[model samples]
Target: MRLGNVSLPVLASAVLCLGALISPAHAVPSQPWYLAAFDHVMRVLVNNEAPAVQMASGSAEQQNNVDPAYYSRVTKEAGTITLRGNVPSDGDLKVLQGVAAAIAPGASVVDRTRINPGVPNRDVWLAAMTFALRQMGKLNTGSASLRNAAITIEGVTNADDDFAVIQKKVREEAPKGLNLQVALKPHDVRPFVWLAQLQQGAVHLSGHVPSEQDKVIFGHAQVLFQNLTINSSMEVAKGEPKGWIEATKVSLEMLSLLYSGSVAISDKVVKIDGIYSSPAMVDLLKVYSKRLPEGFTLETSILEPVARAPAARAEDMSFAAHQARASYNP
Candidate 1:
């Protein structure tokens, strides 16, 4: 029978379910059983196996059987962070581990790494690599190596300026005879060595830059246009004029702060108009202007954008015959 909204049969079922939930289940591991479980988990690891144990004989972590070996391959491809080789110490492991964690958040550490003592001068390249990887924005994908007495570094950054800055830092910090090769994959919209000329009130951008660089610069230029008309005649060619990327970024930063003006960049000189607001911009651009491509000279001109004052609107009042006279007496 039913009791309120419940029945005697339902009450008995609930009690039986509670009894099952209260039941205890114990798990005891035997020596061989635990070993087999570990073997199954590490079956495919490259350096983890019998007879070839990790070589952590006499290092800081020797008591704990931890190796201080140094040879790691950390690469992130297709949204997967793959880690391999061996680490010298827990510090190195932690550094690479941190990189892996950032690349693959909420992802498992597929640790196939072994431990052994590292070689001489491992710290030099290790520190350099970690610094470079952290400096690179967006995608973290690159290989690093330290052999002989030379350090060779090759990596790509999103923006031209960033790649340049990081490259300088890496070279400066690295020991003498360090070989560095850094490049910008796709230069971000930095107002580098390009030209934004406001002549005849028409915006004209012209300079030799990578094909897509035109789009990035114009995108920033258009923002300044507001209601003003834009005449984009920027050319997209194969390569940029010498020192164009740096000049362009400086220009973008210039346009962002200034209201309206012309920024002209050549291998020889960088000129600007309507820059009375910030004379410092001229000095800043001199760095790029010095590296003019082959034959170039300083030039400056500006056709201040002509403001089109809106025409006064007279109410029609639904008139029948509205005579139109010559509006302009030019």
Candidate 2:
């Protein structure tokens, strides 16, 4: 007998020689070579079996209980939408085709998908696919992919305005119960600046912010100033300096400390100018600056209340002390 060109007896001899070279006791542990060969085989099987049994409990997943791998990808190029990947049924395939057609009415659909049964969370998967295709249609040439429960959309558009609009939509209208990531290249603006000004029960926010960092600022605003009206005119742009989000959060915190003031961050410099009724507020500002992350410089122009008559001065000082206490607690 032979395995292709190598004869069986030659193969057996090579295996025996190899086993002899690797044996723990130098090839021949016992009187008979057959016994040594048997020992080597048993040792190999036992060593491999032990690790498999040990790892079975900790690392092995039950095959029958595992969720089906569902994948769907959509790409648009040269006025054509190409749909690819696996769907649960023919109905889902048609639905995805229809979705693509609706998203880009003038473009043709190229279906290259397979029917894959047992797609877990069918409705959610379909919704995510539709959302992905719509976002993809907005781009001149772009791609969106759905693997299991995560969707990623990355591409470019013709105009900066269109890119900004798509980014806002993705951030605001992503499907629930799925992790959606967007990486639309944004136009870079040099000297990235953000401003928050507080006056008369309202805070006006303007300037530039990264796509995801907007939510952070909004969350902080919602909690810090429940009564104040938030008027934000922030635009989406890339090129945020180091420690951008951290510095922004710190700026928001310091802004909350003022009776009326503005926090303007341009590039890596944070300028905080406002009025505080207490001298203690100045000390508080200094402390906040100390905790600011590296690569940031803080400049403050906080003002104290104007001088008045002796009685008014005393009362103002008392109110300032109370304000300082409230700031610490709040």
Candidate 3:
């Protein structure tokens, strides 16, 4: 049977049987374990001291007003790091904290209001932020799990805005399950990335800035995939010239068999070939035309997935299947 564009090989009977054998207990505080696994997966995908190096070319384009370089030393560095298994240490925490501070330096909490009284709203906001940061590669997931396991931020001031207040409340209620409603209105100068992974072990990623102009110029930019069988669709929403670029309507397609190791991803690689056009793209180009180097223009296309050795064990699969079970059972 096929779901979306990918095929499924497992029999319904066997799948149900395996499902039954796996108790909800298998779904307990595996957050730490999942974090470790996710960190390993990212290590394999983006190996380097600074995984954000890929942005250098774009940075140069924005600064020097030149045609952005398509590749960088960081890309090769990531390749080397992924091969060496030199995962970042807890010291990376300081590095990420510095990044967070840099992203929102001088930006105050402003105000805080309670959205959910039953749960620790502050903690939930923080958790969501942490999830966002981890998704952006600013924070090492493994390191975050370790730090958050015991540490708690207290007495943080609340914000006036809904998102800010929500984030503040979530942060205040830390070290607990996040069950709160909060909103976040990060100021300008925030750096981030959009990441999408599938149950079949495929991953799709892109980088963007908060500004609308930046999003228009870079949002419809290059997309990188880790495996091919899965298909992903991403939408880019550019905020004000200096606000956040949001990705919505993101989806992926893949065969369930890949998660069970019954089908090898390398053998079933599929290609996505298409073109995307948007008024935003044209407007962004016009706004940045003078800033761009001669012969430079905004374009969008699918990038070839980086090749890596397959996981050696079932535990190494990307979080799709595990997360799916957790989402349904949790």
Clashes of 3: 22
lDDT of 2 at 121: 65
Model 1 quality (TM-score): 0.34
Q: Candidate 2's error at 224, in angstroms?
A: 2.6
- Estimate, for each residue in 1-330, the C-alpha lDDT of model 3 and write its tens digit: 443453333333444465557667764455433444445444544465244643552454344532222110000111111101111223433343444445344422111111221222223334444443322232111112112123222211212122233444445644355332322333322122333333344433332223233334223322323334433232222222212222121111211112221111111121122211222333442343234333222222221222334453333443433443332211
Each prediction's TM-score versus the true structure: 0.34, 0.45, 0.17
Model 1 segments more than 4 A misplaced: 1-71, 99-112, 135-140, 159-163, 169-184, 187-208, 211-330
Tens-digit lDDT string for candidate 2 (1-330): 555697756766776676667657654445546555545555545455645554564433433433566788989888889889878789888888888888888898998887776566677888899888888767767899999899999877543454467778876777888888887876567778888877667877878888767777988887888988988777777788988999988898888887776788888988876677466777787788887789899887676756566466555444543453343211
| lDDT, candidates in the order shown | 0.47, 0.75, 0.29
How many clashing residue pairs, candidate 2? 0
User: Between prediction 1 and prediction 2, which has the larger lDDT?
Assistant: 2
- Provide the RMSD of all predictions against the true structure, rounded to 1 decimal: 17.1, 20.6, 28.2
Better of 1 and 2 by TM-score: 2
Ranking by TM-score: 2, 1, 3
Show model 2 residue runs off by greater than 4 Å: 1-153, 157-159, 162-164, 167-185, 307-330
